[model samples]
Target: MSPRSASVNEELRRRSRERLLQATVELVGERGYEATTLADIADRAGAARGLVSYYFPGKRPLVQSAVHRLMHMTLSEALEREPVTTDGRERMARAIDAVLGLTRSHTTLMRMHMAGILQAEGFIQCPEQQRLAFLLEDTVTRYGSEQPEHDYRLLRALLMGAVVALLLPGAPMPLGSLRAELFQRYGLEWELGTPPQDEEPAPR
Candidate 1:
């Protein structure tokens, strides 16, 4: 057989990287960050241990990219879900719910991700993170922001704060309250997005 073409090689590398990211999410979620090792992630991915280091400088960056990929996928799905509309407010609502929902559905993974952000390594600017930022910035633009760059940063900061509040040790805030605050800030109707069944209408 002839040597693989460049496109084929690129595709293979993409798949390999994705497997490592997925494995990091799974193993870290199941075992918590400290207990999960790089070797464990490689084994889980069925790839060689060296590939992890090749794709990421360290476990923190790997985990951050993985979580960013997960967030981007989740936000994309919510925005494109059936009954989809280009309505900016609705899209914004879905975006908020998507990120907030992850806190509940993937608590451990989100917690670890947030913790990693606070570390000295700071935010990892990988492709996955860029993708996530694009989606969020697009959402802000759709929401009629005159300055999407500034608005996007503000929206991100708010979401990050909400996530931290939700995950705060022994002092977590209620999800509905957090969601309500966001919705009110954006003037979103309470009925918008995937609101919890028991969520009350935002105070007028």
Candidate 2:
């Protein structure tokens, strides 16, 4: 083949691969990782099945890529909503508010992440998941002046669990009130007066 033709083909393939990744993230975020298939991603991305296979090798890689994209997007956006502070207590408070706001805004995406982790042990064991967990741990570790690592981990776990439970179906309480209580329990009483924002997280 001619060099010009080869270069054009390569560019097209690169664009197609990126589109597939984007489509996978959007579909997984909306439907779910398990529910979405290669066909669906191909259609959404305007790519061919053969091309997806060429780019991703298999479904696992595609899912992993999608998860990585989703996590990075969520974390980047979440980190931006509040100012960075050095004081551990203040930072922890801001982080709490940021994370809670992120969860509330992107319940569907958060649910997809939770569901993915629960259903697939291998998937959850991926390095991206480990990295994400470490990021959470690091954020919480900053608040460990008087508390032990175990205590901080426990508090973080409890806080995350409460948020999930409150968000799950058949919970008979108001989400707003429940989230407020959570923030207060975490010593973030300052966020109580802030109005709710309507920004949703990007799809998985």
Candidate 3:
């Protein structure tokens, strides 16, 4: 058989990395961060254990990238979902809902991710994270921000704060309240995006 071309090799590598990320999300979500090992992730991905180390310096970075990938995918889907519109307010609303929704849907994985961020490693600026940043920046631009980069940073910080608040142990705030604050900040109507079934809480 002929040797694989460079493009084929690159594609293969991409698929391998994605499998590891997907496996990391699944295993960590199921077993929690401490209980899930790199070997377990490799086995779940059907790849060599060494590949995990090759792609990531350690378990923390690997899990961080995996969570970022999940976030990017979730945000992309929400922005491009059926009945899509380029309306900035709508897109911003979708973006907020997308990240906030993850806290509820992937509570364990998200909690672990937040914990990792607080560690010495800080935020991992991996490709998956860059992609997520790009999407958010674009949303900020569409939302008519004069300083998109600055606004993007502010938006990201707010979302992160909201996520942390929702995941706070034994003292979690209500999701509806968080959503309300975000919508008010962005000038989004309560009807935009996928609002929770509960009535919007009155302003504090």
Q: Of the candidates shown, which would achieve the greatest lDDT relative to the real structure?
A: 3
lDDT of residue 180 for candidate 3: 93
Tens digits of per-residue lDDT for model 1, 1-204: 345687788899999999999998899889999999999999999999899999899888899999999999999999999997899999999999999999988999999999889989888899998999999999999999999999999999999999999999999988999999999999998889899886665454
In candidate 1 the C-alpha lDDT for residue 167 amounts to 98
Can you give the TM-score per candidate against the true fold? Answer: 0.96, 0.60, 0.97
lDDT minimum window of 10 residues, candidate 3: 1-10
Q: Is candidate 2 or candidate 3 better by lDDT?
A: 3
Query: Any residue pairs clashing in model 2, and if so which?
Result: 29-204
Judge candidate 2 against the unseen true structure and give its global Cα lDDT, from 0 to 1.
Answer: 0.61
Candidate number achieving the greatest TM-score relative to the actual structure? 3
Error of 2 at 109 (Å): 3.1
Q: Candidate 3's residue-wise lDDT over 1-204, tens digit each? A: 345687788899999999999999999999999999999999999999999999999999999999999999999999999998999999999999999999989999999999999989999899999999999999999999999999999999999999999999999999999999999998888899999886565677
In angstroms, give how far residue 145 of model 3 lies from its true place. 0.9
Which of 2 and 3 is the better model by TM-score?
Answer: 3
Ranking by TM-score: 3, 1, 2
Off by over 4 Å in 1: 1-4, 201-204
Model 2 TM-score is 0.60
In terms of lDDT, which candidate is stronger, 1 or 3? 3
lDDT of 3 at 13: 95
